[model samples]
Target: MVFKRRHKEKLIEATLFWIGSLTIIILILICLFLFRDALTLFSTHSFYSFVTGSLWYPTADPPLYGLIPLLLGSVLVTFGAICISVPLGITSAIYISEIASPRVASFLKPFIEILAGIPSVVYGFFGLVVLAPYLQLWLDLSTGQVALTGSVMLAVMALPTIISISEDAISSIPSSIREGSLAMGATNWQTIYKVVLPAALSGISAAVMLGMGRAIGETMTVMMVTGNAAVIPGMPEGIVESVRTMTATIALEMGEVPIGSEHYHALFAVGSVLFIMTFLINLAADIIKKKYRFKLEGS
Candidate 1:
């Protein structure tokens, strides 16, 4: 019996050890795959021109791979998504954390999570079928496929992420803080605004950063809704004009690109830019959190 128990323990330990090792190896492999492309990008192109230029004509014999328009389109759509999502998400989070009854919270929280689980492709389909036609009629645009459509879709997709994170942030605030504010004759809303929000600002900021990352990386939905025009045709006036995004550019063109071609490396370079941008945003959030943490701990 003692020998059998010892063997069982050994087997368990070996299994766990192998699992951890395999996970690390898989992560390394993924990093190498992504990094290989980035290295190729640097080898093939001037980093300055690739990031800063305006044109992205990859099929052209020389392939002017300026990523500015794609970058602009991504920023525009992400900006629109943030505009739509932040206020709505924050408000919903506040309601869930501070205002909603437990029954209401129970009902709504899962629904919001369910919204998050809906695939991007489905969101794309919804945009194409339902949103595109409505926008065309309402905006009197030639085609409904535009940045606005993509923005709206991305906003919807980002909603659950923002809401969930923000809700957790709000919920993390100490009830003592709320009670103290109320003891000082503050209204519930006032207490929430003055005490809870200030206390939870770090986490809320993190949530926004996370949502921004999601907005930046989204591909299929943006591709489906944004009319894949590489050119923005002067300053973007409305959502009716076609736009192309970096992720979309990669998805659309990578398949056709010959192995080791300039266009292929250029796409990887664009992806690297995206990864760096999102990483910086997240790093900024972390810095903000640390700064606030220092203040909180010192006080």
Candidate 2:
């Protein structure tokens, strides 16, 4: 019986190992496929010009594939989403974790989870059908399908991730720390802001980073709302302008572009850029978390 139990344990271990290995292998295969197709575009296009060029006329006579406009659009949308979501998410998280009654916390958490579970398509549809008209009327723009509109929708989508993770982080803080701070004559707010927040800084930072990643990578909602113009907008005033993101460009054109053509290869190249950006963002998040954890431990 002991030998049979040991054999079962070994079988389970080997099965888990193969599952993990398979996931990594699939990821590597995807990267290989993406880069292999992406490199074909560079054969006829200058890498530097492709990246720095502002125009994205993929269907033009000569076909310009400059990525600057798309990159700028993504940056603008992500920046706006981060600015709007971070403060609201953190504040809500703190309230839920530290201030709310257990009943209230339980209610709010389920609602946030529901929000997260809502499909991206539904969010996109809401943005297109409801928010667009409202924004247009309020902003006095010809059309409301602009970068700011996408940003607002993306912020809504990112909020759940930020709030959930941050609340967990804040809740995970040791109860002893809070008691000690109060014993030292600190007010509840003071203890929360100074002691509790500092202790959970690493986790909160991770939440923010993950939220930013979600905002940056969101494709469907942004594509549906942003007017899909492939032009660089002027600074300061351009946040309200219609623009196209890299993901949007690929999604919009990939279906219609001829197979084995430059446009096809270029779309793959765009995907490759996006893949790299996501990888770098995740890597940076990890590095930031480690640095903060080290500091907290040292202190």
Candidate 3:
């Protein structure tokens, strides 16, 4: 019996190892594919001009392909979405996981699940039809289809991911930790804020990273609502101004461009930039998580 159990364990371990290895292989293939097409974009255009120039006209005579404004747009919208989602998502998770009754949490979860399951196109439509008009009237912008509009819509889309994961992280903290804090005369809020949150910081960081990744890669909703104008606005308040993101740019223009044309290659290059940005963002989050976890454990 002992031998049979050991054999079964080895088989399960081998199966899991191969599945993980296959995923690594798939990721390597995807990187190769992206860089392969991306290199062609720089064959004719100077890499400096492609990155530094402010214009993004792909159809004009001697068409220019600057990435600064698109990057800015992506940054602004993502920053705004993070600002909106993090507070609300983390707060809701705290309420659901720690404060709320099981019935209340159950009632809330289906709505979140429904929201998450809705297609991006439907969110796009909602942004276009419902949110756009309200922003236009309330903020008095020239048009409602701007970075702010896209940011809000993306925040809504990211909320389910953030909240669900964070709640799980908080709920998974051992009951002994809570009991210890309570025995030390900590108030409920103090225990939650001081002990539980620190214990779950790594998971919260992961949740935030995933939510940010989702916001940054969103295409349909951003394209439909962000006005798709590839120019940096003049003022800081221009976060409310029309802008375009890299993902939206690729989605909007990739279909009609001729195969192997400069435009086509350029779009692939944009995708590569997006891939790098996501990698860097997650890397930074991971570093922070490690530092925070070390501090908590040491204390």
Leading candidate by TM-score: 2
TM-score of each: 0.89, 0.97, 0.95
Query: Clashes in model 3: which pairs?
Result: none
Candidate 3 local lDDT, 19-80, one digit each (tens): 99999999999999999998998989899998898999999899989998889899899989
Candidate models: Cα lDDT each = 0.88, 0.93, 0.93
Residue 16, model 1, lDDT: 100
Error of 2 at 120 (Å): 1.3
- The deviation in Å at residue 205 for candidate 3 is 1.4
Flag the better candidate by TM-score, 1 or 3.
3
Model 3 scores a TM of 0.95
Clashes of each: 0, 0, 0
* Residue 11 shift from truth in candidate 3, angstroms: 4.0
Please report, as a residue range, the 10-residue window in candidate 1 with the lowest summed lDDT.
Answer: 231-240
What is the TM-score ranking, best to worst? 2, 3, 1
